[model samples]
Structures are given as structure tokens and as C-alpha cells.
Target: MSTGTLYLIPNTLGDGDEAALAYVLPAPVRERAGTLASYIGENAKTTRAFLKRVGTTRPIQEIEIHELNVNTPAGEIDKLLKPLLGGIDTGLVSEAGVPAVADPGALLVRRAHERGIKVVPLVGPSSILLALMASGLNGQSFAFHGYLPVDANERIKKLRELEQTSRKAKQTQIFIETPYRNKSMLDTLLSTCAPSTLVCVAADLTLPTETILSRAVSDWKKKPTPDLHKRPAIFLLLAH
Candidate 1:
């Protein structure tokens, strides 16, 4: 029997407003996802909630939602893919944003390729790209460096290096922080980067509360700090 295709599903940026679902994902993508019987998600509970919004054709309870997160063993990849090998179409759902871009599901995607299973990426919201789009920075060249070091000193050192790289290469450097650490990340960015470097803090993308702030480091210090506390945000910087 032919192996099933692994549908790379994109989850919303945030659950700010349920009414906004209609516009976040295209109708065709949602319709197709609704028909899937199996899914491999970063978090099964959230995946079920997302499918609930899509109004799955079959009862959500009947659908198989398996978890594949940061803690999932690499050796277990093939096991999770057994259903797909049996010709069961499965969706690789991310906790947020597109699957595989900055998500752990990339491993599953690669294994699927080795097994000759088709991989399909559906259109969806990606906070990283969306932030860069509105940041008024160098869109022609950019790089996303997932997360900086958790230690303050290390993160600060990393930020300085990224800014210098952006200055010399004219490339946008992008990264994200846990919701609770958003404010801390912003603080590090403001203090560590050069005064003229362009910094963008895009929060709540695609949600009703979406906010994109892009300005020089000096200018950032002049205005009241945004309430980035506990808010999911994507940070971008470009140096001249």
C-alpha cells in the first residue's frame, strides 16, 4: 500500500479572539484539515482545541491526536509515523505557527521524506515572517535565530553579536521569547544594541491585540515600554 501524505498544518499565532479564526486561516486549509482522521501535534490538547474551531467532519473524540514535542525521543519518530505508513493521512500540527519552520516537527517531516511519504505545507500565519514584513527592515536578506540563551549575560552577548552581524551583512536578525520573558528580552535588546540599530517587537500577530513596534534603539527608550509581559512576541533587528 502507498504511504500517506503528511500534511504540515499551521496553528494560529494566539487565541486572542475566537471570531478572528475565519480570517486567520484560509477556508480551503481549514476544510481540508477538518477531514483528517489523524494528527501529530506538539500538544494534543491544543490540537484538539484547534480542530474544534475548524469543525472537524468526524467527531473530535474519534480523531487520533499524538504528541511530538521537544521532549519526544528522536528514536520514536518512526513509531509515531506507523499510521501514515499504513496509508492513514496525518496532519503534523504545530503548537503555533507553521509546522517544521521553527518547530520540532521538522524531525518527523524529514523521517516522512525518507519513508517516501508526501509532505504538504498548508498556508498559515507565521509571526516571524509577519513581523519582518511590517518591520520596515531589510526584507531581501534576513535570518531567524530561534531563541537566545536564557542566561542574561549570554543572551546579551548573543544580541550584540547579532546586531554586529546585521550591521555588516545588512540582514535582519529575528528571534522570539517565552511570553513571560518578553519584557526581559526587550530590555536586553534596548540596552545591548547600538542606539541607531532598528528594533522591532511584534506581538499578538493575527490577533485582535496585534501590535508591531519598529524603531531605533534610542527611540525605544524614549517611549513608554510596551506591556510585553506575558505576551507572545517576535523580535527583529536590522543594523545600518
Candidate 2:
């Protein structure tokens, strides 16, 4: 019997707006997603909603969705791949964006590789890649740090370290913050980095309120900061 394939599925970055979903995801991806009956997701509710949007032929209630999140123990991750070992292809979906890239699904993918199961990643919108593409920063050499520290002092220290790294290596540093803490993160960035450094803040990507702006730290200070509170955003810093 052949081992099953592990499909790394991607979901919309923003709220489930049909137009945005249609524009970002291709028909082939949606069609394939709809055919799968077994899945592992970070959040079950969002996973069902996404499956429905993709036109899944299987009844939402009937689909097998195993939850994988930060709370999931490393030892139990291997059990999640049992369906694949039994020759049943399994789909892995995250709360949003691509699975396993800065997402909890990475653990499952790593285990799949160890078990010699086929791992396939489908095409989808990644906020990290989209922000890099539009930021006009050093995309050729960049790093995504996921999220910065929430503590004020620790966050400032991390910002300085990233700034130094960006300047020394000419590599763009990409990171994110919780939606509600977006404004506070922006304040730290403005105060911690040098005035000449460039900061790109891409907020509400793929949504009607989408905004991607890259400007010097000094310039950002001169203008009124955009209200980013309660908004999903990606931040990139480059010092050339």
C-alpha cells in the first residue's frame, strides 16, 4: 500500500470575503481542497468555513478535522499523521495563510518528512511574501521573525537588534504583531530605530482597507500614524 500525501493548504489572509478569496486562490486549488475528507487544522471552525467556501463535496460535519495548535504536545503530533500512513491523503489548514510557515502545522510537516510521506504545498496568498513583494525592500535577502515581544522594554531591544542586523547585512527584517497591539508596535518601531532606516507597514492585506506603505522612520514620525489598532499587519525594516 502506498503512503498518503500530506497536502499543505493555504487559506485567505483576511475575513472570508468571496471576492478576495476568488481573486487570490485559483480554481484548481479550490477544486482539490473540496475533494479532501480528512484534514488537520489549527482552528476547526475556520477550517470548516474555508472548506465550505472551497465547495467541498463532503458534508462539513462529516469531514475529519484533527486540531493542531500550540497546546498540542510534540509526542502526539506523530499520531496526527496516522491517516496518511494508512494511505489516506490528509489536508493541513491553518487559521489563515499558508500552513507550516510560521504556523503550528510545521510540526506535522516535519514529522511527515521523517515518515517519508509525500508532502505537497499548494499555491496560495502568503502575507509575508505579498508584503515583501510590495514593500520594495531587499526581498532577495530577508528574514521573517514571526512576532515581536509584547513587553515594552523587550520589544524595543528586539527592534534594535533587528535594525542592527538589517544595516549590517542589508537584509530586510519582517515581523508581525497582534492586531490589537498594532499601534503600540508601531510606536516602538518609530522610537527604537534610526531616523534614516526604512520601515514598511503592510496592514489589512487583501481587504478593502488594505494599505502597504514604506517610508523612513523620520518621515513616519512627521505624519499622523495610521490607525492600525485591531488590524492585521506585516512590518518590514531595511537599512541600506
Candidate 3:
């Protein structure tokens, strides 16, 4: 039997903003997701919600869903691939953005490649790419550091290092912070990065409340970080 293909699905950035679904996701992606009978996702509950929006072809109860998160052991990923190995086409999705990028499931994708299972990625909104596009940064040579150190001092040091690297490499350094810590992250970034360093804060991407601001650290310090509290955001840095 031909090994089944694994589809990498993209989830919306907003929290249950179903209205934005048609705006960010293509019809082909939703159509393909609705046809899949199996899925692997970081959070089953959210994945179910996503499928519901996609209007799955089969009854939701009949579709099979498996979990793959940061907590999933490396040894267990192969077990999750059993269905695909047996010719069951499956979808891989994350809580937000595309699967296997910032989220878990890269291992599953790698394993699929080794086992000869085809891997396909569907098009959708990715906060990282959206932010970079709007930031006017050096997208050609950029690196995405999922999340910086959480510790205050450590995060500051990391920001300095990223800035220096950006200057030397001419590469855009991108990172994200937890919603609740957005203000603190911005504060440290403005304080730690050089005055001329270009900083971008893309918040609430793809939603009606979306905000994307790119400016120099000196200009950013002229005013407050703009109500970033409890909002999903991506930050980009390009040192001069």
C-alpha cells in the first residue's frame, strides 16, 4: 500500500476569531483539511475547533486526532506515525501558525520523510512572516529565535547579543514573548538595544485589532510601548 501523506495545516493567530478565518486562510487549504481523516496537533481541543471551522467532510467523531507537543517524547513520535505508515492521510496542525515551524511536529515531519511518507504544507497566516513582511527588515537573511530567555537579566543579555549579531551579519533577528510579558519584553528591548536599531512589534496579526509598528529604538523610547498587555505579538530587530 502507498504510504499516506502528512498535511501541515496552519491555524489562525487570533483567539477564536472565526470571522478572520476567510481572510487569512485560502479556500484550498480549508478544503484539503476538511478531507483529512487523521490529524496530529499540539492541542486536540483547539484542533477540533479548527476542523469544525474547516467543516470536516466526515463526522467530527469519526476523524482520528493524536497529540504531539513539546512534552511528547522523541521515541513516541514514531508511534504517532503508525496511521500514515498504514496509508491513512493525516493532518498536522498547531495551536497557531503553521505546524513544524515554531511549534512541535518537525520531528514527525522528519520521521515521515525517513519512512517515505509524503509531507505537504497548506497555506495560511503566519504571524512571524506577516510581521517580517510589514517590518521592512532584511527578510532575505533573517533568523527566527522562537523565544528569548525569560529571565530579566538573561533576556537583556540575549537582546544585546541579537543586536550585535544583527549588525555584524546584516540579518534580521526575530523573536516572540508571552502575551502577559509583552510590556516587559518591549521595555528590555528598548533599554538593551542600540538607539539606531530598528525594532518592530507586530501585535494581534490578522485580526481587526491588529497593529504593526516598526521604528528605531530612539523613536520608540519617545512614547510608551502601546498597550501590548495580554496580546500575542512578534518582535523583529535589525541593528544599524
Model 1: weakest 10-residue lDDT segment is 14-23
lDDT of 1 by residue, 51-142 (tens): 99888999999999899999999999999999999999999988888999899999999999999999999999888899999999999999
Tens-digit per-residue lDDT, 1-240, candidate 3: 998999998988876555678788888998899999999998788789989987888999888999999999999999999999999999999898888888888999999999999998889888999999999999999999988999898998899999999999999999999899999999999989989999999999988789999999999999766899999999999998
Clashes of 2: 0
**Could you tell me the lDDT of residue 191 within candidate 3?**
86
lDDT for model 3, on a 0 to 1 scale?
0.91
Model 1, position 239, has a per-residue lDDT of 95
TM-score of 3: 0.97
Query: Residue 200 error for model 3, in Å?
Result: 0.4
Question: For model 2, what is the alpha-carbon lDDT of residue 78?
Answer: 89
| Cα lDDT, all candidates | 0.91, 0.91, 0.91
RMSD of each: 1.1, 1.0, 1.0
Candidate 2, superposed: residue stretches over 4 Å from native = none
